[model samples]
Structures are given as structure tokens and as C-alpha cells.
Target: MRSNHSASRVVWTLTLCTSLALLGDSTLYAVLPSYHPAVGIGVVQVGWLLSMNRLVRPPLNMLSGWLSQRLGPRTPYIVGLSIGALSTIGYSLCRGFWPLLAMRALWGVAWALLAVSAYGLMLDVTVESTRGRLAGIYTSISYFGGALGAMGGGFLVDALGFSPAMFILGALSIGASLLALTLPRTQHLPARHVAPGVSLAWRPRLQAWAHALRRLDARLWLVLALSFAHRFLFAGVFYSTFGLYLQQTLGESLHVGAAVIGVASFTGTVLFLRNVVSVLVGPGLGYLSDVLGERSRVLLLGEVLGVAALACLALADSLWISAAGVLLAAMAYGIVPPMLVSWMGDLTRTGARGTIVGGYQTMGDLGSGVGPLVAYALAAAWGLSAVYGLGAALCALTVPLILLVRSRAAGRAPLAVADHGAHGA
Candidate 1:
């Protein structure tokens, strides 16, 4: 058994590690669409490169979960961090569509290993009483790396060009991997069975997967749906297209007095602002959900805010108005993720939680993966505003589903956050 203080340290360390690992990935999001041609890719290939890692994450998520269950989080976490650093290095050196695509896919594998292990480890060490706050803490600190990555990466790219910027960040990522060596070798002891004569038993390779699938109930299904919808719009479409949209609306460079801001620099600043808001609100909103004793309510409000933000962003022709939309969107991004993960914590136990979290993340990955492809294709056909409008509509459609989950929870006996019964699925 772990003490709260020890668990808290673990959560913080894991979060910080992930934050560093994310430097390359988030920086790419900030610079890629605009710099696509600089890296030997056409405009049409931009979305594919942006989303390739995500597209490969679904299966990798499952693999990460199973590995976490069998070997504990420490090993995979270290390995993932190493891979992430290598992939960043690859990004710095590689050119052309195929090479960049391969690096993106490699990053996907890294994320799967890091994310599932972190979530599983958090659950293993913390209780219901501490889960929400720790989750909030995890989210808050995790985005610090993203915030820096976007802002610094843009400045670096603008000042030193793409390869140098990436190489510098990749070196930093290697430092993060070294930091992981201090973590305990085994966080969650793998469950084992021993019997007098039961050596004759047989277990299939995918038995864990089958069991995880069988465990999904209506509430779990709702979690998956919410994860899918939220990521599709927020991380997927919005992240992939926001730079292009900015270029279209604001032009290649913005001249404010003596200062000239290129599209990548401006995009990075906006992205940095968005992530700063996420860092600021992630913990507070998570604590709010804990205080309210209902993650669903907080999530519902965030979803609605997402709808409004998208609409605002779609129509805003002025800078301040667009900033407002970005602010709202940031709040939505911060609020939804921790609450959704905590809600999953509410509905699951340690035994099945790893696989279940994997499933949830896989759905999110699938949505994010498909989102960039769809958004780019649609934006080309119908214009960026229409694509934003479509995102708003999709966000709006998720509201009723969240309400249903809230109502169902209200009508039934509240599921205990730390319930270890066989009810988990």
C-alpha cells in the first residue's frame, strides 16, 4: 500500500515526465501546417502527417495497457520517454512525406506507452478521495511542457529554423527520459494465481482484451462516446487546422506597430495562451468537480462552452473576438479531460482500470486521428468557417448524452469512486 504523499509524488513526476515528452508533438502542432512545405510535404499531405501518430495509437494503447498490467508502469514509462525523445530527433533529421509520417507514427507509439502507464499508475497508488485532485495536478503540470513547446518551439523555429528547434527540444526530451530512472521499478504488482494442481489451465493471449471489452457497461460506453466526440473536435480538428485558419483570416504576417508576427509565431502565441489557460484551470476545475461530487455536471458545462467557442471562432473576424473564443475553448479543454478521467475512476476498479483507460484513450485517439483528415478535406471544400461550424454542431450534439449520464447517475445509487467490487466493467 502507498501513502498519499508518496502517491502524490508519483503522480507529479509522471505528469512532468509526460510534459517533457510532449514537447516535440505539441510543437509540431504549432508549426507543422504552416511549415509543411519547408519539410518536403505538400499542402494535401499536412493533415496526414499531423494525424498519423494518432491514427496508429488505438492498438498501441491496448498494448501499453497490457504491458502496464503485466510489468508495472515504470519500465514502459521509461521506454516510452526514450522513444519519444528518439522520435523528436527523427523529426529534426527526417524530411519528405514518408519519413515524417514514420516519425509521427513512432511518436504515437511513445504516447500510448506513456499515457496508459501514467493513468494506470495513478489509479494504483491513489484512492477515490485523492484521485480527482491528483488527476488535476497531473493535468495542470503536464500542459506546462506543451505551453513551453508551442511558444518556445515557434520562437526557436522563427529564430533558428525547424531542424535546430526540434533538435534542441529533442535533447530536452532525452533529459526527461533520464529523470524517469528514479521512479520505483514496480508500481502495481501484477496479479498472479497459484493453485495446488491448476497448472493445466490455459489462457489466450488476448484474454485481457476480451475481458476488458466484456466489462463495458452503459456508463462506460457513454464515457467512450464523450471521449471520442471531445477529442475529435478539440484536439483533432481544432489543433490541426487552427494555424491554417489563422493564416486565412489574419494573413501571413500581422503588423502591429513596429512588431511583425508571422503566422507560426502568432499561432504559437495563441496556442501558448490556450495551454496557459488549461494549466491555470485544470486543477481548479478538477477540484470544483470533486467539491460538486459530480464530474458529469462540470463536463456538461464544458461541452456547451465548446459549442459556443467554436461558433465564436468561426465568425470572429477581429483579433480580440478570436482570443475570446480561444479562451473559452481552453477552458473546455482543461475541464473535460481531468473530469472524464476522474469519472472513469468513479466507475472502475484497479484490476480492470488499466485496460478500460486504454479503451477510453483509444476512442479519443480514433476521433483525433480521423478529425484532422476530415477537417482538412471539409475545409478545402466548404471553407474553414464551415468546418468550424461543423465542429460546433458536433459538440452541441454531445450535450444530451452527457445529460443522460448525469440523470442516470442521479436516479440510481451513486457509484462509489473507489468501489472494488465485481461491478467494475
Candidate 2:
């Protein structure tokens, strides 16, 4: 067995490596507008390019889980980074929609593989009690990298032009692939086997999937629903269109707008005060949920705060107001993922953890895919402000859904007892 220090180092290294690999994704948004105009595609087509990447996640995530079980997580993780590097290089040469779309799809598959594998490895390495804090650390680093990637790509595109900027992204991805090879080999240990004659056959796969759906434990479902909507709106409206909107509506230079949003988001995520708050206060909230036995309450608090932040953004008349909204939203947004992941860990058995987490991630991607399309449609009909308002409303809906989940879970055990007593009598 590895020492705790060794395990922690491995987890952090993997997290950082994953973050670097994902930097390519951030650069895509920066480079696409420039590339699209050169290739005669409308701005709306860029949204399709973004969403299409997510369209692959649901099925690809399922495949990733099975492959990880069979080949070990590290193997697939390395493979993913390699493929991602190649895809990034290919992206530098693309001139048309079809080539770009194909490269993005390849990148999506690589993302699914690396994400599922790396998360599984992280869970395996860390103690359950420390999972939330570790998750926060992981997410914070990832977002920090994203901010840098976005800003750097924008600057590079402005100075060096699109193809050369893409070449730099490809080079970074290749470096990340090299780093992935150094990850510890613990994942190669064989998983504990199921009993003989017990097979995860097609029928069982379908049955397990059905049971997972039906018994979806209301709390887990609520988290899924909230994450889906939250990410969808954030990605589709805020991430996908915010730069374009600022450029078009506010007449800000694209490079300046992208850099400002990137810097603000980065600064918000890296706040030492926020990290201290998450470390000190997040666990107290988590422990309270454990004691009260109500995960939904914590989730509701986070979502409500998020909705308020979104509303603030919607009403903001200046860049400063938008920056403030992002800071507030980041605090709440930063809290939810770790809390939800910890809750899932608490509710699941060790054997099923990988599959469940993979499913959860896939659903988040699905939401992300839908969000952009919906925002685009709404923007076309009404306006960009309408898109932000709708995001706030969707976030607000999560509050009630969380309460419903809590109620259902609370009643489940008592209802089981009543049924048993009636059968005995």
C-alpha cells in the first residue's frame, strides 16, 4: 500500500496533469470565432461546434467505465491524453466545418476517457473523510488552468494568429500526455471479482441501468438535475455567448473581453479566502448534512445562492457588475460540485462508485450540450438578456426540486416498515 503522502501527491499530480490536458478545450473557444469567420461559418455554427463535443459524452462515458474496469484506469488515462494530443495537432490544420467537427469529436472522446479514469483514481487514492476537500482542490486547480488557457489563447491569437496559437495548444497537450505517463501504477491491481455465474450481461446491464434509474435515490437525482441545468446554462449562455455578446453589443474588442472574463474568473477561483472558507466551512456543512441526514438542504443552499448570483449578472449594466456577479457565482459554484460528489460517495457502495460517477458526469455533459442550443434559440427570439434571465430561473427551480428529493428519501424507510407490518399482520 502507498503511504498517505504518496497517495496525495499522486492525486494532485493527476489533477494538475488533467487540467493541463483540458487547456486545449479552453483554447477552442478563443480560437473558434477567428477560425469560423475565416471559413465562412456564422457565429451560431460555433455553438453547434461546442455542443457537438458534448453530444458524444453519454455513450462514451459508459464505454469508458467498462474499459476502465477491464484495462485499468491508468492505461485508458494515458491513451486518452495521447489521442487528445493528436487531435489538438490535427485541429491546427483544419480549414472547414467538417474537419473541425471531426477533431472536436475526437477530443470529446478523449475527454470522457481521461475524466472518468482520473476521477476514479482520485476516489481510490483518497480517504472518504477528505474527499470533499480534495475535490475542491482538484476543481479549483482545473478552473485556474482554464482561466489561464482562455486568456493565453486569446492573447496568442491576437499576436500570433489562429494556426500558431493552435500549434501551441497542441504542444501543451503533448506535454500533458508525457506527464500522464508518470502517474502511479496502482490502478493495475485487479478488481475484486463477482461470484461465479454472476455476469454483467446485456440483461443485467439493462436491469442494473433500470434499477439505477428507478431507485435513483431522490437525492442523487436532484443533484443530477441541478448540475445538468446549472452547467447547461453556465456553459451555453455565460461561457459560449458572453464574449460574443460583449463584443457585439458592448463593442468591446474580442481579445479584451475574453481576457477580462478569463482574468476575473481566474481571480475569483484562486481566492485564498474562498479556499479557506471551503476547507473550514464546507466540511461543517457537509457534516451537518450527514447528521441531519438531509443532503438536499445543503444542495438547496448552494443552488439558491447560485441563482441570486445569476440574477445579479442578468441585471448588471457594467463590466464591474458582471465581474462582481461572477465572483459571487464562483463561490457557490465552487461549493456544489464537491458537496454533490461527496454525497454520491456516501450513498454508493465501493463497487458501483465508478459507474455511478461516470453516469453523473455524462448527465452533466448532456445538460451542457442542451444549454447552448436553448440559449441560442432564446437569444434569436428575444435577446441576450433573456438568456441570462432564463438561466437564473432555471437555477431557482433547483431549490424546490432539492426539497422534494429530501421529502421522498425521508419517507422511504418509514414506508418500507409500514408495508412489512401490513404483510405480517
Candidate 3:
């Protein structure tokens, strides 16, 4: 993204690209849990497949941060997208467990590069005060696109065969990559590094962060901790296990292609509906966060609702009850991120945006990795329901931390001033 581009253009372009990428990838992700087991992979091993991205994310995140400075966000964005396209194609043809695992790992690298570049691009196009609103818009598109993508992929898989469905999804990524070529160049992110904003040596950079972390205030630390836990529940437990749970709940399993698709497709539709809630509610939440300037209250509410969502999932007696839970969870998911990122934006500096966002994402990555591995082990020892119960407890524990965010004078005093100042008519 060229920093000089119109915000509208950046928003639409980025949103569209994000949608395409997720739409393509979610198809594969939505199916893979059951698909893997059908092909003879073990349940514990499925956790590894779901989480292969985490293996490369920590280091790659740092590298992408540094790399984006030198090469510009556009270069990595395009290259990473190209790889995403190829990876989807790889999934279509690869049959061996090891090869598929490697592809999943490669997708992780692509994701790291894409996320660092994309989020940095977001920071470039907006001011600190405007972050909540913009972050909400971005998150809305991300979730909305994800919803459409997963739903589309599910139906396609249901109608066509798996390989054919993958081919179609792969093509979507290719199309998105081509569309990315038309993106306007960014001035904040120049084509090549004119200044040394980032260190090339990883060790020195790592050491620098080690020293720099001591200066953070209590609230920032709390945000990071919450990020880790929230993502843990999201990536590790919910996503990795949800499909399997559905299968178990419905008494469906591997090799029964149509029956399996019926169950998976239903879950995909539920996810689609949840994302729709995100799309509908996201803008309003973003606006609320900006007006209140007190992101903590909004964030805390989201956490509380998250606990409730988990409870619904854990103790669900019927699909309707689970759907209600999903709606609650989705709304909470929609609500918190804009406030979280906006709140974090307030705490950090523009110069440190790259590192802060990178670190923040890495925290989520850590949660995602740990959440699933532990969930898989626990579920194996216990059952799927245990994972949701634990998730609810952890989410409950984080509400207090979110409560500690000190609201800005702008947040506490008068929102009308903020309404005009942050978003001009």
C-alpha cells in the first residue's frame, strides 16, 4: 500500500484482497480437519496441521517487519499472495501427509509476510485517533470476507469433489494476486529502503526488544496478555476443534463424503452467519469505541460476552442453542478487536508501530499455537467439551485486565468533540 493513496482506495482494495485470500484459504481450512482424518491422519496430528503456521510465524513476523521497511509492504504483500495461490494449488494435488504438512507450514510463512505488511499498511494510512474506526472497518471486512469464503468453499466442496473444489479456490487466490498488481504504490512505504529503520541482523533486533520491553506500562502488558489468551481460544481451541466437535455431536465421520460435507457445510454456514453479524455490528462498535475513547469498557464487555459464548458452546443441548452461542461469540469477536487495536494504538508510538504490531500479532500466534496443542492433548485425554469449558474460564479471567485500561480524557470527557475531531464530516 502506498501511503499517499486515498484512504477509501486503500480500504476497499485491502478489504477486497483480504476477502479473496480468506475465501480461498478458508475452504481448505474448513474441510481439512475431517479430510485429514479420513485419509488416515490421527486426531493429535490434525492439531499440528491446523497449527503448522505457528511454527514459522514468530521469526517470520520479525523478518516481515524488517523486510517491509526495505522492500516496501507492496512487494511482500504481492509475493506472499502469490505463494498463497500456489499453496492452495499444492493442497489440491498433494496426497502424502508429509507433503501436505509442508504446504500448511509454507502457508504460515505466507500468512506472516502478509499480516505484517497489511497491518503496517493500515497504520500508514491512518492517524492514531482514527485507529479504532479504521481497525473496525478492516476487521469487519476481514470477518465478512472470511464468512463468504468459508461458506462458498463449503458449498463447492459439497457439490464438486475435494480436488476440484481446491482448484477453484486456488484460482481465486491467483485472481486476487493479479488484482493486487494494480494496487497503487505507497509513499510511506517506498519501493526500496531509503533509511535504516530496521536492523538486518536478527540477533541485535531481538536484543533491542529485550531491553525495550521494560519500559511498557501496566495496561500495555495487560493488552498483550489478553491478546495471547484470546487468540489461544480462537485459533487453538475453537477453530481446530470446532469441526471435529460438530462431527462428534452429529455422529458423522470420515469417508462418508456427502454426510461429512453436510455436517461441515452446516458449520461453515454457522460461521458465515457469525461473520455476517460481524459485518453488521462492526462499524457501529468501531464508531462507539471512537466516540467513547474508552476502549476498555467496550473491550471488557466483549470479553464478558465471550465467556457467555463459550458457555453456550460447552453446554449446548441442541444446534439452536449452539447457534445462539455462536452468535454471542461472533458479536463479542466483532466488538473487541477494534477497541483492542485502537487502545493499543493509543499506547504506542508511530515509529514503533511496526514492532508493536508485530509483537502483538506474535502474541496472538503464541496463543494460537499453545491453545490448540494443549486443547488437542486435553480433548484427547478428556473430551471436546472440556476445551470449551476451559476457554470460558480463561476468557472470564481476562475481564479484569481489560478493565484496567485507563481511558483517555477524550474518552471520558466529551465524545462529541471526538466525533468531529477524529472523523470530520
lDDT of 3: 0.71
Q: What TM-scores do the predictions have?
A: 0.83, 0.76, 0.78
Clashing residue pairs found in predicted model 3? 2-185, 2-186, 3-186, 3-187, 236-372
**What TM-score would you give candidate 1 relative to the actual structure?**
0.83
Please, what are the lDDT tens digits per residue for candidate 2 over residues 1-425? 33457556766787777767777777776567666786456788887776666788789887786676556567778888888887878777887778888888998899899888776666555544455656656655665666567767777877887777778888988898888777754333356588999776798778877986897666667666666776786644666666555554446332454464444344324343444443444545555555555555666777777787778767878877766666566666666766776667556543245666677778778877777778788889988777777788888887777776676676554111111111000
Per-residue lDDT tens digits for candidate 1, residues 1-425, read 45667778778888878888988998897788789888999988987887788778889897888787677767788999999999999999999999999999999899999888877766666666676778877876687776676767877998999999999999989998998887764434356776877563356536864785686666778888889988999888998899998898889998989999899778867877788888888888887887787778888888988999999988888988788889999989888888888878777755446667788889988888778889999998999899998889989988998777667667665343443331111
Report how far off residue 387 is in candidate 1 (Å).
2.7
Models ranked on TM-score: 1, 3, 2
TM-score of 2: 0.76
After superposing candidate 3, which stretches have Cα over 4 Å from the reference? 1-5, 31-50, 92-95, 154-167, 182-207, 243-265, 314-321, 379-387, 405-425
The candidate that wins on TM-score is 1
Model 1 misplacement above 4 A:
1-3, 27-50, 89-103, 153-168, 184-215, 255-260, 411-425
Question: For residue 100, what is the lDDT in candidate 1?
Answer: 90
